[model samples]
Target: MSEISREILSVGDLNRAIASSLEERFDTVWVSGEISNFKAYDSGHWYFSLKDEEGQIRCVMFRGRNGQVGFMPQSGDLVEVAANLGFYVPRGDIQLTVQSMRRAGMGGLYEAFLKLKAKLAKEGLFDLQNKRPIPTHPRVIGIVTSPQAAALKDVLSTLARRAPHIPIVIYPTLVQGPDAPAGIISALKAAEKENAVDVLLLVRGGGSIEDLWAFNDEQLAYTIAQSPIPIVSGVGHETDVTIADFVADLRAPTPTGAAELAAPRRDQMLQELDAIMQALLQRVGQRVEREAQTLDQLALRLNHALPDPDRMREQISGWQKRLNQAWLVRVENWKRDQGYFQSQLEMLNPQRTLERGYAVILSKEEHAMHAVRNPKELNTKNAFEVRLAEGQVEVEFAKLGLLK
Candidate 1:
């Protein structure tokens, strides 16, 4: 018999064959396990392992697939993955090409969130009537957020741009994790206790459902509902919503949105003020024009009724006394009318108020009109203009009180 011939395969060929065979047999599968050794590369690819007590498997999720996952994946998370069983020809290793993934036990948390939300709604805690209106111009804006969070920077920058003169007070707290709920509650309480800020802003950056779970706490929701100061919640991105968001007086899509809602734009306010001043000037001019026409008509009638000097020459002495009395009466009436108009103009002058010991507080940057009805409205760091009768004085109030 002739020698039997057999084919020998190289390492590359073997790996390729195995990879092709695995792809053909197990097209798709569902696997449940705990995630571990998770790493995300700059290329946007995610590499991790799905492991059980007995075994483990390597997984690869490319940028396109993982980008749609919504929430960020982290190690130690239990998840169910839908993927294709595949083999890596280069490493000669078996791996999973993940198509999608979801938290293994998220349904229960979502159920709890819905239940608490429904309960609160039934109790009218989320009623529109109960929601307080945010002040158009808050004297002091209070912020409850993590001091180290990027959201704080966004909020501060927005507030500075829109209304730099407004004072801000920050109550720092943890925005996530197991202790975040308590920290938030405590911060709200402290802001109320201080009674400093006119409005409260509760804000944080975007995160996964688990990362935002602190805001969904039952106690935290109740605390927000019961807060004395009106709360503006800018908890996450536009699409992300939480229990606190529903309970807040107003909901802003972003931290910057919250700032915008809390204060009016300085430029817009100035334009409105200018329009009002122009309207007043136009009305005053019209009134003066009308009054002058009436005075001219009265003078014409008086001239027509006067006796002619040449015709009354013989009785000049007799008529002189009557003319003198009539002239005196007319001159006195004109003086009284002039005095009344002058008083009216003086009353409308702002300088009159300043002369009467009242000063106007104007913001240095935005020039926002502010009345210092309460001492708390003053901030030592902010500059202000105090317009008096003689001249304006720029001053900063470090501390304010009645002098002993």
Candidate 2:
């Protein structure tokens, strides 16, 4: 008998080859089942078994992938997951590595959501420029919701508490069921026609996708886009999104949130107004102070420019004193000069010489007298006169000779 030839394989190598074959043979696939024995480890990895009536599969969803699921899955949750098939080397077990997950039967709703969101976005209905700004101080707030709904009560209470002074108008309508979309649109139209409210709130409570589907209606989206007044949509919880949220001017998480957004708190607004007034008063005071300082500077300049009466008087008095002193000096000088000239004149006078007993002889001829200066001019026959200081005497020049 001949020995048969066989290839030997290790456990690790077989498991690796099996894992590779499984991954390569099957493309990414989606499977639906009820979750069982779901466990979330400290490492944020989820280990669970997905089972149908007749079969079950082990699945693992890493933290990185499950974080995008938006909600945690419990053991009984009916979910669909997109996964890749693989064989675990250490345990030699078949397993699925999950990439994404969502609640079962939500596929159609999600698809519709995406389609509508894309359509509206493409038409510019969700543009920031097209959206209106929510009023910070609304005088009148309008609500569009079911009168019997619990969400209406929450909105009313919030508005009453925050802005009691603001008047509230209720446009009651259906917020659920098949006719809710049309009812909401009619209410919006009514609010527009009345034009009484400064801002409008479209509010509803949180619910499943089916329960909140009315808000995603195409006509409702169009109505919201065409509304003249600003609309705030609070259709569901924070995690829930709808077409109305995209088309409205603003979106809130809850009905109370919508009320809070539409109406400003009275106390908060009062505080803001008071602060503004204080700032304005401060600015006015500063400006007035600056003007006052400028005025004072101008006044100082003017004071310097104008003549001071007291100073001018002092200057004038000094000038007058100096002028008087100069006049007195000139007068004394003139008097002194006059006295000296008078003395000189007195010395030149012949009367003083005559008064000193000196006499002058004159010759008289043809009824005129002449001084006899030479002996030849005075003849013996001619009459002569002797002049003295007091009087003149008649005489004859009998012997006019020089006596040395």
Candidate 3:
């Protein structure tokens, strides 16, 4: 055999050779173990030991790779890591540099789910204020899901049972696989554009987080939040919650539950209608009674205001009799006054006084002279006249005489 020429290798060279060999043998691997001695540095690097019942290996996740890990690794957490073997020359130790990690059974999809959830939550997408109120009784319930999905059947059955009269419009889309997210978003947009439905139900059957991964998409969650119509998410079983669940207006544990919440029961609505009808009837009856009572009161007032015909006639008769008596009394008093005035006139009449045997004497100037006491007072040469009641005579005063 030819003598093998050996070149001494430096520790750095040796470590590099081993690291290259390990990388070549296990460029990417899946390792399941419990985490131990985990430490996270301010630099965002993570160092831990992955231990099994048999043994444990040191691990390091650098800042870039660990940042993609949605959840922080804790000591004693059961996790699976996808990593490549690396050798440190200075320490002369072998360790794994993790590229990704997830909870054991969930796979890498779970990490993506968690990451998207945390991001949306931090941005306030999951806030209660952003959530809308589900319609109490949707006139039309819109469904966004694969037509072939069993969840669709479940929802339809539930809705029919609850609200048989409500109309339903289906906006069919893929509920799983890689194309599901885009399909879901398109369906949601289509439903909104139609503008017919009062509420939307985005539903899917129960499955692994991978099967429901489309619902966990950040864009899908945002679309649901920004939808003009209220959205009720029923993406999976009760225990499974997706990003869509947090951003939706309402969350239902199952597809059937979503249908139930979207509408009111027919029987219950009928009961309410009946109650309202009865109340309205009662109010109308009371109003009619009140109006009738008012009419009766008005009739009583009219009766009181009307005058009695018999009493009016009697009053008119009494007034006529009093008026006739007053007229007679006035006529009699006038006659009495006229008779008294006539008597006074007769007493003062000059012709009547002459008829009482009174004589009148006149002077020469044709003036009356009465009671001549001395005859000498008369002028003989003057003519004098004497008058009786019926005749007058003229004479001369021949002799003087005194008369009283």
Candidate 4:
């Protein structure tokens, strides 16, 4: 150019331009450094400076991004971060916006963990529909764990205390190191072959990620998924998760937890049984009372159906006097009249009705028998007596199937 011209720009404008250029010029990066001046605000944002022996840089990790970090970073902690280059226009300084972070040495292992978790999840290994129900009352419980493991002792004690009647079979195996996965598989196969236990427990105590790495093996996950008996996995502490935990039918927080889940407490089951028995007895009492009411009603109907015996006797006496007068007046006609009156008297007799399959139902109340005249006069709560031609029998209406 022949002539040079100077253009004035405001401080804010210059800073904004630089910030835009910095954001566009750099892609996301991985940085390794030691943390310094680490501060976590109430807003959940993290503000810190990452430094090495040569230089230091300002960094900010917002709440959304920082939550994914497994561990919180302290001032002296060495960290590896994946971040994007950014600039703070107000402060006129360059800074790194962290996307994810981890302890420096754990970066590779954490990455692998994430990769495997994602791959398994895509294959539907962790679906809720795939899980089998843990037995409420296992006849026999099988445990797969190291013989030397403290978890085994804890599980045994819990199962014995909760359900002493149930038997336990232990399949000892290695729970750590490179050989653990294969050993656990063998133990599981042995348990399957024996088929003595109703449910199986795969358990171990808590350990570091590296120490528990055997549980993360792909083959071990496949084995747990393929087991016919329901598997309850208790591999580590509550916070520690493994592939075995996901593949198992049920996951418990600890070995003792697994035992508690598999075995129903004897005392608790007895309490439930007692409650059911009481409820059934109460129902039976109610049913008996209702049946008595029905019988009382049927007895009242029978009372109404029968003619009064005293009234019949008085009518027979009057007829006998008439027959005696006719016999004296005409002796020849008296024989025929006598036969007709005898037949009439026999027809009116209560015993004749009883012999013809009729029964008088009486209500027994306060140790006394009373004629069941009306339903309101009888006590439905007491047993009823039926007077038949041959003998009297006491009965409850509910058992006779007459009401329903």
Best by lDDT: 2
lDDT of 1 by residue, 87-190 (tens): 99999999999999889876677788899999999998899999988998788899999888899899989988887667677888999999999999999999
lDDT of 1 at 137: 71
Tell me the spans in candidate 2 whose CA falls farther than 4 Å from its real position. 1-7, 41-43, 147-150, 308-404
What do the candidate models score in CA lDDT, each in turn?
0.84, 0.85, 0.81, 0.82
- Model 2, 1-404: lDDT tens digits are 33455666899999999999999999999999999999999999999999999999999999999998877899999999999999999999999999999899889888999999999999999999999989887878889988778998899889879876676778888999999999999999999998989899999998878889999999999999999999999988888899999999999988888888888776786577557656865785676568657755655665677678566556556755775676568657756765675566455456777899998887656443335556678677877788898998887656657999
Give the alpha carbon lDDT tens digit for every residue of 1-404 in model 4.
33456666899999999999998999999999999999999999999999999999999999999987766789999888999999899999899999999777776775787788788878888888988888897878899988788998899899879887676777878999989999999999999998988999999999767778889888888888888899999988887889889889999998889888899987897678657656865785676568657755655564576577466556555755675565455544544565675566456445576789998778665433445657665444677888887888987654245675
Candidate 1's TM-score: 0.55
Model 4 misplaced stretches (Cα beyond 4 Å): 1-17, 24-56, 74-80, 88-93, 103-133, 147-161, 164-169, 193-196, 205-211, 237-241, 253-256, 307-404
Provide the clash count, candidate 1: 0
> How many pairs of residues in model 4 come into backbone collision?
0
* TM-score of every prediction relative to native: 0.55, 0.68, 0.47, 0.59
| TM-score, model 2 to reference | 0.68
lDDT: worst 10-residue window of model 4: 364-373
Better of 2 and 4 by lDDT: 2
**Every candidate's CA RMSD:** 12.1, 52.7, 51.9, 26.7
Which has the higher TM-score value, candidate number 3 or candidate number 4? 4
